[model samples]
Every structure is written in C-alpha cells, then in structure tokens.
Target chain A: MTVKVEKIEGGIPHNTIMVAGLIASVVLVYLTYANVLTGTQYFAFFGGLATVAALVWGSHTIKHLCSYGIGTGVPSAGMMAFGSGVIAMLFATKYGIAAPIVAVILAAVVGAILGYVANNVLNMKIPVMIVSLVEMAVIGALVLMGYAAMMSGSFELSALTTGSVSILGLSLPSYQASFLGGALIATAFMLGGIAIQHPFNACLGPSWTQDRMLYLAAECGFLSMIAAAIMSMPLISMGAALVSLFVAVIGWYYTYAKYIELSKRDAFSWLDSKPIPEVEGQ
Target chain B: MESIVFGIGITALAGALATVAGAAENTESDIGSQGDPNSQVQLAPQMGYLHRIFNKAIAGEPPAWGLWIALGAGIAWAFMAMQVNPILAIVLGAALATFVQGVYATTAYLGRTASLAKFGQPVFVDVLKSMTTVTMAHAFVAIFATVTVCHLMNAALGHPFPLPLLGLVWGIALGAAGSATGNPFYGKERQYQNQKYGAGVPIAASGNIVRYAEAGERNSLDNGWFSARLGGPASGVCFGLIVFLELWRTVLFEHIAAGWGAIIIGIIIILVFMVIDRYIEVWARKNYGPYGKPAEEASS
Candidate 1:
C-alpha cells in the first residue's frame, strides 16, 4: 500500500497573523498614553517598534502583489501606498487623538476607492489588486501616525500646528513643526515606504517564499525603526532614543538570523565555500 | 480625555485594513568625483541608436562625463543666481535642474547596466528607455514637491529655508525615489532561463521583456511617443496638486481644514489618472498585443 504525502499549511494565514500582531502593538502603545505604561521612554521605544511592525506587514503585501508582475512596476505600488498614507496621517494629526475615528475612516475610504479603480477600471490585472491597495494605504497611515505620535511625544493637534505663526496672510514655521513636518515625518514616511517594499523587490524569483519574505520583512522593519529613533534624536528624550536603538539592534539580529537560516536551507552552500587558492596577502 | 477604544480602533483598523491589503500578499549610485578611462564607464553597443542620440544630445559619451562637469558649473551658477535676483534664480535653477537630471539619467544607465551584467544578463536599450521615462516623471515630481514644501514651510514659519538646505532635501528625495522605483524594473525584465536554485522564474514566461504600460513596439518611436503622452501629463498633474495644496495650506489659518480640501482634490487627481491609465490600457491591448505592433505598422 502507498501512502499519500500532504503539503503542510502555515498554522495561521500569513495576513491574519501579521494583522493581529499589528493591532496588539498599537493597543499596547496606547496603554503608555493611558498612564498604564508610565514613562516617556516607554512610549517612544514601544511606539517606534509598533511603527516598524506595521511596515513589516506592509512589505509582505508588497511581495504578494508584485509577484504577479504588475506592469506599472513594484515601487509605484509602494509610492501610491505612502501617498495615501501621508494624506491620512496629516488629516489625523490635525484632529489630534480626540477624533481618531476620522483618520481611520479617511484612510479606508481613500484606499478602497483607489483599489476599486485599480482593479475595476485600470484593470491592473493582479488577482489581489483591490485588497492589496486598500491594505497598503491603511498600514501606511498607521506607520505615519504611530511614528508621529512617538516623535512629538504625544498625539496632540499641536504636534502639527505648534510651530507656525500667522503674519501678513502667511503662516510662519516653528522649529517644532519644522522638525516634525520636515525631518521626522519625511524620514518615517520614506523609511516605512522602503521597509515594506524593498524585501520582495530584492528577493524575487523561484527561491521566494512567504516564510523567507516575512523574515526579511521583519529585518527591514527593525532597521527602519532604528532610523526613526535616530531622526527623533533632536525631539525625544535621549533615554528613549537609546532604548529604541538597543531594541532595534536586538530585533534586527534575531530576524536576520532567522532569515539566514531560511536562506541556508534553500541556497547553495558551495557558493559560500572557501576558495581553493588563498589571496596574495593571506 | 482618553478613549482607548477609538484610539486603538484607529490604529487597529488601519492595521486591519493594511492586513486585507497585507494579507493579500502573505509575504513574501554613486557617481561623481572620479576620472580616467579605466574608471570611466561604457555601455554595450547593442544598446543601439537611442543610446547614441542620448549621448550626443548631452554632449558627451554615454556616461556623459562632459555633462557631469557642466552640472557642477550649473549648480555653482544657480547658487550665485540665488543671491542676485529671483528671475535669475529661477532661470539658473531650471538650468541646474536639467543638468542635474541629465547626470542622473546617465548615471542610472551605467549603474543599471553594471547591475544586470553582474547577474549575467545582457541589457537592452529598453532598459535605459524605461528608466529614463520613470526618471523624468519622478524628477518633475521631486523638484516641484521640494519647492512647495520649502516655500510653504518658510512662509508659515516667517523664516526662509537656507537655499543649500532646500537643495539638499530636493536632490536627496529625488535620487531616492528614482533608485527605489527604477532598479526594480531592470530586475523584473529579465530572468534566468534555467535556474532551480534562483528566485527569478518568470511569473508568466514568454521570454519577452515585460513593460508595465509602455505603448507600441519595443524600441519603436510609437512606444516612446505614447509613454511621454501618458507619463508627462500624469506627472504634471501630480506636481500641480502638490503646489496648489501647499499654497492653500500656507495662506489659510485653518490649515487642517485646508488639508481636508487637499485630500479630496488629491483623490480626484488620482481618479483622473486612473481613468487615463484605463484608457491607455485598453488602447495598448487592442492595438499592440504581447509582441507589440507589427514592424511595418510600427514604422507608419
């Protein structure tokens, strides 16, 4: 008698697993604001980690959709996602944490409409086009808002408008707003964009697997959070930045090791073998 | 003052929404300051006539060392002009922007060629062509976006941004976006014919290079023609929206109120592109097909 072999499935669907983690992270960060976590360092460090986690999920989706070979190119998908995200975050911060629901509704509506148009009208022809577009936009918003809150040290309307003056029908810039708008927002914006999109773009082909991509995603996300911490140096407490830097290094090393392990399993070890002839110096 | 439910909901839903998008996939340059023939880069001949034309127009070889020199001068001139007059500043700035982009295009071509060659795949002119197309769009977006951001921020803050600082922001952002978007197209266009150990199995293999929305035959005039027609307007619209929104935000006391308007307008602008992109898709599919237009038809 012959026995049939069955292909094993991931214990939880990849998307489900990532989203659950993302939600948990956001809620945990909010606890810091609620006096539940206590300490500026607590908010900054955890908030940075949460922001990176969102991008990790974003990167996974990028890999999923781009694998289909969207004609417009992979980075376009990332750009489009960030574009919507930037808008949502700006609007959300304008309202402060008081009206969080507005930004959520705003991001979803924009993403859904864009996705619908991409799939139905543009005929982007990817099987996952609509869902991918919406998710990308929404996550983009989360990454932006989360990082903004951490850097500003709170989720207040003043985070956006605090640094400007009104003069002769023109608004003047304030150092705080400039730092947030220009440096902090710009770094998080671009870093989150790349963290989510770069993995799949770098690792496309037959060797590409969900497991491997997620591992790489985790690595990129941690690195970007480290970037956020560095950019936040002028604004956040030094303790917060130091803690974030430490956590990022540990997070990156762990994820990178997992990625290497996966890569070793699939890649040719011969490629890493020592050369038959040593270099002249050696 | 705190509602954990709503606050958490905002992030949670956004994350969940990203999940739907996320669950969807389930996962997955340096140019400058050097010389000598040995150090200078060159392109393969098969890159063809368009390569020659580009080289000639830029007044140097394919890597445009001469133009790189001109770009240095242009930047210096632009900075000087900034001290003289706004009109002169604008003119010199435009000149500087052109040379800056020319350097970028040349560098991108050389950079992309080296990258592909490292993997053992020969690049076609279409690789350069596709990159230049995206570069033009992104260059336009980056310049305008930078100017708008700086101008508005300065106006709002009652202090002007240092010109050098503005230039840095503008140049860095443009360069970043270009490399981010352009390199992937090169990776996508070619794959190993026989590789079990590698990642590059074609998603749908026809052995033909796949371009996203390029019009007409590969390397044909019509292809260049349509790409300009589509990409140019789309980029222009993006630039316009950014400029308008920045202006509106700067002038209004209610900046966030204006932000809402900006968001709506932004969505509309994107929707318009969607309509145009859709129209282009239909046109290309009906007229071109996978192999593109017949050579005879292409010539006409």
Candidate 2:
C-alpha cells in the first residue's frame, strides 16, 4: 500500500509569507541604522528580529526548492546561499547607508548565476531553482547583515571593523573584535543555515504539514536569535543584549509550544512511554 | 597595467589550483560514498542488503570543507605571521587538516557500521585500513590546493579579507560545486547502474542499490576508479570556471562604472548558461522521448 503524503491545502501561500518577511526584515533592520544615528544601541534587538524574518522567508524557499527531490541538496543549497551572500554582504558594507539595498542586489545577481549554473551546467533541472536561490541568497545576506548590525550596532564597514564612536554615553566594540575577529561570522553562518534548513528537514515526510514546519522555522529562528543575543553581549550594552535574549527566549517558548501542539494534532497516536521491559529470555 | 598583469596571473593560477582541488574532492567523496547518495548506502544495511560501502558523511560537503580549509588556512596564517616560509606553512597546515579528515572518516565509518551491527553487518577492518589512507591522500591534495588559492587571493590579489575567511568562502564554493556536479553521476549512474540510462531512479527502488561487482561483490573503492574519470573532471571544470570567471570579472571590470561592469558581466554569464541549458534540455528530451514505458513493461 502506498502512503499518500498529507499536505494541508489553503493556508497562507508561501509567496505571501516571503513578501511579508522581505518587507518586515528590510524595515526592521533599518531600525539598527536608526539606533546608530541616535547614538545608542538600545534598539539593536530589532536586528535580531530582522534575522528571524529573513530566516522565515529562507525556510520557505528551502522547502520549495527541496521539494524537487534533489537529495542532499538541502544543506548544499543553504551553504551556497551563505557562500554567495557573504561575498555580496562584505562588498555592500562599504557603501554606508546604501549597504542594505546594495547587498540585496548583489546577492540576487550572485544567486542567479549560481542557480543558472546548477540548472544548466550541472543539470539539476528544478523549475524554481533560480528564483528560490535568489530568494535564499537575499535572505542569507539579510541574516548575516542583521546579526552583524545587532552585534556591532552598525552595518558600515568602518563601524564594523572599528568600534562605534561615543554617542550618548554608549559605545559598541568593533565587529572585527566581536564578530569576525573571533570568527563569529562562521557561527552566524552555521546558526542561520541550520535554522533555515532544520525546519523542513526535520518535519519532512508524508505526515508533514506546512504550518507545523513554519512554526518550527520560527522557533529555530528565535533559538538562533538567542545565540545572537548572547554573542552580542561583549559588543553591545548588557541591558540591550539581555532584553534581546529575553525576547528571543519568550518567542522560542511560544513557538516551541505551538509546534508541539501542532505535532500532537497531526500524529496518529500520542503516548507517554515508560522504561523498556526486560527480554523474556533474560 | 602591471597590476592588471599580476591580477591575470593570480587568476589563472588560482583557477588551475581550484580545478585540481575540485577534481580531488569529487573523487574523494565518491570513494567514500558521501553526500546525498550516502542515504542509499546507509539504507541498504537496514533493508537487509548489507554492503561494504565506506560511509564517512559526518556533515555535508560545504560545512566539512569549510571546517577543513578554514582550520588549515588559520594555521597557515598563524605560521606566516610568525615568519614561517609561506609554502612550508601551507603544507604543514594542509597536512594537519588532512589528519583531521582521516579521523573524521574513521570514526564515521566505525560508528555507522557499529550501529548496523544488529543488521549483522560486520566491520571490515581491511576496508577501513585501506580506504582511510586513500581518502586522506585525496583530501590532502584538495586541501593543499585550496589553501594555496586562498593565499594567492590574500597575498597576491590584494583581497581585503584575511586568509581563513577566504578559505572558508572558496572552500564552500568548491564543496558546493563538487556536491552539485559530481554526486549525481555517482548516485544515478555509478551506484544504480542496473537501471536504464536517462531513466531516473523510481521511488520503489529507493533503498535497493546495485550491490554486486562483476566478479564477486562491490565496495566503495571501486566507485573511485569509475567516478575519477568523468565525475571528477566535470566537477573540476565547474569549480574552475566559477573561480576563473569570478576573479576575471573582479580583475578586469570591477573598476568600470563603479563595479556595474562586473555585475553586468555576471548577468551575461548567467544568460549564456541559460541558453546552453535550454539547448541541453531540448536535446535530451528529443533523444530520450519522455522515459518510454513503465519498468515492468520495459523489463517484460
């Protein structure tokens, strides 16, 4: 007997979520810039929220692309997104206020090229490969830049490499010292990647539903945000980092509970088991 | 003008090194039955078709390569900072990284096989003893070449990023290239050779891989010999072109119109590949004619 995969139809479409995520991320990340101009890092947690928004979009794209049955491409696609995104993000950071837009454009172009090569040269032949890749790449750039902004309280290359100047009796450490110097970008890369990929990967199968997967994605995003907040402790003010951490923890708890509820609703049977029994021969 | 010439030289050398690294990486992965195809290898024992395929997939290619190359380049960078000879430093770093790769490979194999003990799959110590060295050798070559390319990008091309960062980036690209290009050949053609060409693996035949050799029984080492010829070279070209074109655009066109020229060139390259892909797709469809008949009908 064949097992038919159950997909709950008529939820919010992926495209809509993607668009909402894009808008929310862009606007939220700009809050960091605003905080920068205001001479305070108090609003830096907005950058963590921005990362969560980007990961939500990224998780959808990963699901769309992996549905094509490119076995093992899930992690590769995630890594490739960040690989190209890092190049574009680093280049864009040089442009100051224009950096975010520049990063989006550059990442889109790089992702398109990589996607084209995957389709044409390598012959993966998934229909949505190019567009999904472009989205993932942009999302990757946003996550990295957002987390960096949160940690450093600015996305400017100079501000990132060198600590922010004194403003309103508040100063942040250089990103080079706090982020790249300790290779925290690598941590960010892995954190963002696992968050984006794990939702679909863990929930994949005939029993998987879109809502459950997405909630898990949000939960994973909050978990990564918690890590980001902890990592920012040395760079940003302790109060700001603590607040970010607190918010992320709250978000994680809510999402995790929702995900568990969804899982229980979907499962054929739910049980609490005791310890294993001894063998008859024993 | 002189700097352009120097840039061109660096691009060429880096591209060449990337090509060799890509080839070695593909061969190494195919030999170990790593990547997406390892799913089949892992499934086989559980499905009661225990085989001797070496399973060494601790992580996906990108993260694995990122760790290896980053560690190598980090050590090399440290040594160079301490006034060590660049070449010697690179070699030492790569050698140490290769050792780490071997450790990962051994543990992965042992651990995976140990878990399958309930399936009556015995640990072939000989397979472990031989395949580990082979994978280590190829990994060394790949790591060495990749570290050199990152060094050139840092020392020669005046790239602002440090050595370890460059290593991490390009190492990911290399692994992505190999995983995308070569894994298909190994997964579809090499492992599932019993299936007809151009007919994709059906869902029904998921865990049932071709386990026997022409003589007695198949092992992972045999896969290396076959994949090295075609899959390895294909992966090499893919990665080599990526490195060459990316560096070429940066070197020649990055200054034109404040870097829009490089962006335009990148778009043009994508357009060219799209055209080629269309041609290939049309050609394959015309030749294969839509998968023909059902498996049962074809066999009958």
Candidate 3:
C-alpha cells in the first residue's frame, strides 16, 4: 500500500497547528499568571513547545519555506521560541527565571543550529536512511548517557508510535524505534515524489529536462529524509535497519509520486489554459 | 543625529533577527545527492567567466590575509575591548563559537530535513545558503560568548558586567561586523555576481577567486589613474579605520552609556563594510572576471 504523509488525510493544517499551539501558550501564560497551573501541567506545556520547535526547525518543512513557501511564516520559527519559553517553564519551579531562560536558550540553540544545517550544510537532501542512521546514532548516544530529556515525554509526536514492545526489562527505546521508522517513511515519500513527477515532462530539451529531474528528486529527498530523521529517532528501538527498511520504500514512493503527480498536474492545467493558484510549495 | 541612532538600532535589530533566526532555523543541504547546489540560496553565482578572470589574475595562491585578519583582529579587538589577556579571549571565544555553531548547524540541519521529509515536502537544495550567515552569526555568537565569559571572568576578578546587556552589545557588534565582511564576500555576488576585494584577501595567482562582485573599476579607461586601482582594500583601510578606531574606543567605555555608544559606532562601521562587501567587493571580483592571470596571455 502506498503511504502518503503529504496532504495527511483530514489531518490538521500546518497553520492550524501553529495557531493552536499559540493559543495554548497564551492560555498557559494566563493560567500561570493566574496561579492556577499545577507544576506538572506547566512542565508538560514547556516540554510540548520544545518538542514542536525542535521538530519544526529540525524538519524538512524549512525547505518548503525556501522553495514552495510552506512553513516560512513567523509562527513557524516563532514556534520554537514559544516552545523554548514553554520548556523553560518546566524548570521554573526548580530554577526560577534562570530555568526558563536557560531552557529556551538551549532549545533555541539546538533547534536553530539543526535547522540551519538542514538548510545549509546537508543541502537538505541526504538519503532517508542516511539521515535516520545519523540521527539515531546521536539519539542513541544521548539515551546511553542517560540524557534523553526531550524524547522521554514527547506526547505531541507520539502519533508515529504503533505499539510499544519491551525487550530488556524496560521499553526498547520506543522513541528511537519511532524515529528510525519515521526516517524510513520520509525516504519512501521522496522516492514516490520523484517517481510520479519524472515521466510526463518529456517535452523539454535534454539538459533542461535532466536538470528538472534533479531538482524534483532533490526536493523530495530532502523533505522526506529530514522529516523521518527528526520524527522517527525515538521510535528506532525496533532496530535501526528494521525500522529503516520498514518505512523507507513507502515514504520514498509517496513523496516522489506526490511531486511527480503535482508536476504533471500543474503541467496539464497550463495546457488547458487555466491559471493555477500557487500551491503550498511552489 | 537621532536618525543615526535609529538606523543603528534598526540595523542591529536586523542582524539580531537574522542571528536569532539563523540560530533557530535549521538548514542542511546534501551535495552530489538529489540536492540542488542552488537550493542553498546565495546572492553569488557559483560559477562565472568573471570568476575565471580573477582566478587567472591571481596567478599565485591567495595569502592568508582575511583569515589572519579575522584571527588577529579578533584577538586585538578583544584585548582593546577587555584588557584581561587579549589572546586568551580571542582563542577561547573563537574556538568555542566555531565548535558550538558548527554542531548547532549539523544537528539542526539533520532534524529539519527529517521533519520536512516526514510530510513528503521538498527540502531546499543550495550549497552556500547558510555559509555566510553562519560565519557572520558566529561573529555575533563569539562576541556574545566572549562577553559572557568575560563577565564571569570579571566577577572572578571582582568586577562584573551586566550579563544580559553585554550579550546584546557583543552580539550586535560582531553581527554587524560579520554582515559587513563575510556577507559581501560570500552573499553579495549571488545577487549582483560582480564584485571583488583585494589587498586584505589574497586569492590564487590565477585569480581563482570565484566571486560575484569585483573591486573598484578594474576595467575603466582611467585604470591608468591611481585612484581606481588603489580604491579597494587599500582605500578601504584609511576610510573605515578612523571610524573603526573610534568605535573600538567605545567598546572599552569607562561607563555603560559609552558601551552603548561604542556599539552604535561599531554598527556604523559594520554597515559601511557591509555596503562595500556587497556592492564594491563583490562587484570588483565579478568585474575583474575571476582571480587569475591578466587579459594579455589569453589561452583562448
């Protein structure tokens, strides 16, 4: 079965997610100011924000902002800042002002650095498993060192989880398993993205046509690879290779096909002489 | 003038914004993969005839001027700013900044790409997208980190600077400087793709410095005159140094307000350099047509 992560079936719009989170933060602040929020609730709020910021900054969606104008809004980057503030709240009871400030600062540093590299160093197009393996390695190291702060409580991204399986006394790093699986999913998407887009554009000249394919493949690869790596690491306790193989083919196919189909569709709409509105990632 | 302060503030704000944005935003592009070198969005064209010309003109390898300057100025600047063992601050701050920002870029890059791919989104494909920004951001990061480290050091030495405001000042100062220097060299040409810088930066004897901008009027009929050829790195020295010195003095402000004034002056210096970095330096390099051997002995 073809798995499509794009155009999630009746899933919340990216913007809606932002707005919802913003509201949550506002309410959180209001509640905190009102002295109504319990300590646990506040920490949870902060944790959620950090996870989202880290995810967004760490995601391939950043590429969308540069190309298709998907997640480039103020709220997108602001999500991390808000998340940082929220995460800081987690340590507020213990550290006071320093807690939130330090948490947000660290979160921002982590999120932004990863985001910058995703856009800059990697050129945002490493292969799915490649990104997954690298992230898993780091996440694993983190887990080993007993510093799995972010993953221990990321209920927001828990949707990637299927069911927890125990191996050695405790859970088999459910977050790591999810992360590896997600990376595979991202890879499958781009493969699909390129597969669907390449065939129909046979009309262009040789060099022009080849360049177009490269561009498409790059986009699909970058997005999926990044997404899977960030979202799937914690889920990767299923074994890196297993999780990678599980999601790789499907993620690549859907993502590649989605773009290929979009390209063909966009190409055809122009043929019928209809102007198409600029879609999410132009 | 009030306009100057406002402009300084606004400029500082812009650098700060980009710094924070760069700090927060994730950018990772793969090369030789499905990634597009273009996706890295830079103002300078990666390849050009002008770049070839400069490469040919350079004839020899570029001297380590820019690098040395960055290293040396960094130390000197630190010493002047804070007399607590200047070289120590430079080495420590620059090293720390490089390592920190480097890891930050690597992890952020990985995380961002993974997320985008999660939804089957297309990741950007550019090579130089974050190169200049990261370098310049380091200017800010290093400055801020230095200040913080210095602040702690000061406390240990029975003196302390306001932690928050010191970060703000150091960040703004270095950011403005970086935007002025690195951006023009790396960022400007992708836009104009015709600029250059000389003297301070030694390129290949073949002028292999492939940049978008060129310095001064390399091809003017008046190339015979002293003004045009002498204008770039050489002229830049006299023109900007006075102001640079004044600002340096300000960073060592005996009073807090002086520090603010110093930051403002430093911003001006940075802005001036940025203008040159973008317009003049880049234009010169591009116009000069690569850093290489002159037009006479053409292999063509």
Candidate 4:
C-alpha cells in the first residue's frame, strides 16, 4: 500500500516556474497592497498564497536533500531558508523597484556562504548543504517578500508597521499602533514559513510525493493568509476575514484529499480499523 | 473602537493558533534515522569543537557554554547598545545570536548519528535533515515567537524595552534548553529507533531523550498525540511567557543599575529560567515518559 514517489529533482524548467511565480506574485501582490492594482486588496491574499506555492520549490529541494538527511531535521532546512530570507527582505525593502532583483541576489549569495561554511568550515561534510542552503535562502527571501507584499501591500518597513495606525478613530498612541503591527507581522513571518516547512516534514517517507506535498504547501499558505487576514483586519476591508477563510477552506479541501488518499495508499492493513490480536510467542 | 478590540482578539487568536500549528508541524522534524529505506548515504565528517561542546550539554552534562555564551553576548550587546544605538543593536544581536545557537545545537545533535555510518548510514543527508527540522523549530517557536511577543508588548503596551537584549538572553536560554531537552529526546528515540530500524546510537533510559517519535510502530506518525501536538508548543509558550515577563522586568527597572542592569537581569533570567525549565522537564518526563526499553536492550 506504500505509494512510491521517484526522487524528485527539479531542473531548470521547474526552477524557472518557481522563481517566476515568486517574482510575479511579489510584484503583483505589492501592487495590490499598495492599491495600484485594479482589483481589491484581497487579491494580495491570493498573492501571498502564490508566493508560498512558489516556495514549494524550496520545500521540494528540502525533500530531495533531506532524503539524504540533515542531522538537525527537515525544519532546520526551512529555518535556514527563511533565516536568510528575512535579512534579504530587509535589504530589498529599503531599496525601491530593485527589491526583487536585489533580494534574489542577496539570497543566493547568503545561501551560498552559509552552505560553504557548513560544509568547509563547520566540517559537517554535508555535500548538498551548499546547494540546498542556496535554494533555501532564495526561497526564504521569496516567502518573506511575498508575504510582506501580500500583507502590507508593499515591501516598505512602514507598510509592515503601520497596521495599527489604520484602526479607525482610535487614535491609539503611536507605540501601541506600531507594536501591534510588529507583533502581527511577526506572527505571519513565523507561521508562513511553517506552511512551507510542514509538508515535507509531515508527509515524508518512501510514499511521499511532490504533488501531494505541494498541495499541503498550498494549504499551509492559506493558513498563513488567515493569520495575515486576522492581523491586517484593522487595515483592510471587512472582507479580509471571509476571503481568507474561503481560500483556506478551499485549499484545505485539496490538501486533505491528497492526504487521505496518500494515507490510505500507505496504510498498513493490520493498523486499519480494528487491531488484530497478537499471536502467542513463537 | 469595537473593531480595534475585535482586531486584538482576532490577532491573539490567530497568533495562538498559528503557534500551535507551527509547533505541531515542527514536532515531526525533531527526529531523523539512518536506516530508512528512502535515505541516501553521504560524506561522514568528524565533529568539531563547538559540536563537542554542544554534545556535552545535550548529553545532560552541565552546559558549560551557557554562561560563557551569555556573558560574551551580553558584553557584545552592551557595548553595541551603549556605543552605538540600543534598539537596532538588540534586534540584530538577538537575530544573529539566535542563528548561531541554532547552528550550534544542530551540529551536536547531528553528530550523534556517527555510529550509524558503519551500518551504512547517509551521514551527510541525515544530519542536514535533522538540522533542518530542529533549527527551524528553534527559529520559529523560540526565536521568532519570543521576539514578536516582546515587540507587541513593547510597542502596543507602551513599555521602555530594549528589544535585542531580551532577544539575546532568551535566545541563549532557549538554545541551551533546546540542547538540553534535545539530548534526552534523541536518546530515547534512538533506543526505540535502533531496535525498530536496526542498531545505531545508544541512548540512556533515565528519561534521557523525551521520546519525540510517537509510540507504537517504529516511526509511525500516529499513536503519541501529546508529544506532537501539546508538548512542544506548550513548552514553547511557557518559555516565551517567561522570556517576556523577565525581559519586561529588566526594561521596566533598568534605572536601578545604570546600563549594566540588563547584564544582571540577563543572568538572573538564565538561572531562574533554567530552574523553571528543569521542573517543566521533570513534569514532562513524569507525565509523558518514554515508551521504549533501554538502548542496549532494545537494540539487542
């Protein structure tokens, strides 16, 4: 009953799709958040989802490399990716128009440096540590920038911190608004990364498949969007919650379907339904 | 007014929910094995000094590194805060130190799998996967969650806070705790794991490793709900709350010791947190104890 997925190696085309999705989602989401886009700001919600979907490439890299095993665990790979991501995002946000390009470059360089250190200086001798880390770094940047774009409507620091200011008529003290915003974004940042890391870690085994994992990745992304919606509800229109819930529910459908299928496909018969009585000692 | 309150409620609810979900997913990443049929072998490298230091801590020896790491980090932070700017320095310092601790803990944790190489282990890949899981868990649950909460309190609650200083203290504490907790969890799991999959590393049964993997079938994701869903996040939230309260005190009472107050506060925090964390550990052990036999017996 084990569903066997081949070793998934994403080549140039696959990588291109992920990168393209990341850029497109970030740019479009940013525009939507900034009110430059034609549609409602809620489109940025989907953009956030897309950004996470793109990061699925990074997750796939984790799956492929983790099959080799990272001594710390699968989540370490995701953390490393996102760790570099937040830094690159900080730098990119400070620069306008050049944000995506700058972030990508910084992510690659940072990831490479981290990988080199782990392999050479750290002497851990993880062969793919360099490439996996490099990919993870880029994915991390995309996730951060993409999430930022979706939530704040732009990559600017102010956009991220200004959530509390949008609360109508409260005239809440400056500190209160700023603190509220920071907390909210921090939540999104932490949780969004989870969406990417969770699929590979949870579903891994011989029976794991990239397609199924990607579905879970989308579900995770939707879950993150829900967090974003809750955080940004003060800033955005009332529909943010409903829309976010709608997307999450829909995404969960696909993710859960694949999960059930995979589980059934991989289940051991003895563990199904009732447990069989144990035989006497041989 | 009504909406703001509603927003606050939703944010807290969402943050808590996300924290739970993230922590649960993180639980899966805590363990890796060498004998998996799907695994591939890679280069086996020797452990370094830092890894050895971390190993001692993980193996339940008094963590010699905590005091030194904290003192060193505190000095660096104080210098930066006094000489340069306070806020940015704290943030960067915390962020950087957390990342460093993440690497330190992960390296030692991975080193334990060296024994599996003789039995055809994919040392490199396994280590990386293991590192990936635990590091991310530390980063998300311990580091980010703590920082976010601190910022929320500082800004929203209108406290005079030094963000990074709190982050640094909490980071070191969490790192130490993660290392300390990790050793036993790894020990117990390896015992059950070696028996289930084949011989590998030895683990003490004195509740050494906290049995991260669920009970029942080897590596089965089902069976143990407590470890996966509750244990990690519950501990994480508790740790975060402790960090918040302690750091809040330091910032609130910084006038007491000139600039050096944070250092004193930091040390007190480490000591107090360690004590509380130990009790928490004992409670966890007493309640959700390991399900496996001794490593020797199980593997045999």
**Best by the lDDT measure:** 2
Off by over 4 Å in 1: A1-12, A32-41, A98-101, A160-183, A270-282, B1-169, B172-300
Query: The CA-based lDDT of model 2 is what?
Result: 0.77
TM-score for predicted model 2 compared with the true structure: 0.56
Q: Is candidate 1 or candidate 3 better by DockQ?
A: 3
Candidate 3 local lDDT, A160-269, one digit each (tens) = 33324455546443432331221222222221222222221111111122222333433333332323222223332324323332343454455445544444432212
lDDT of 3 at B4: 47
Higher-TM-score candidate among 1 and 4? Answer: 4
lDDT of 2 by residue, B228-263 (tens): 999999999999999999999889998999989999
Candidates sorted by lDDT, best first:
2, 4, 1, 3
Better of 1 and 4 by lDDT: 4
Ranking by TM-score: 2, 4, 1, 3
lDDT of each: 0.46, 0.77, 0.29, 0.47
Per-model DockQ against the true two-chain complex: 0.02, 0.03, 0.04, 0.02
Of the two candidates 1 and 2, the one with more favorable DockQ, higher being better, is 2
Collision pairs in model 2: none
Q: Model 4, stretches more than 4 Å misplaced?
A: A1-34, A124-127, A164-181, A270-273, A276-282, B1-253, B268-300
Q: What is the lDDT for B113 in model 3?
A: 31
Off by over 4 Å in 2: A1-282, B293-300
Candidate with the larger TM-score of 1 and 3 = 1
User: For every candidate structure, what is the RMSD over all alpha carbons to the true structure, in angstroms?
Assistant: 16.7, 11.9, 19.2, 14.1
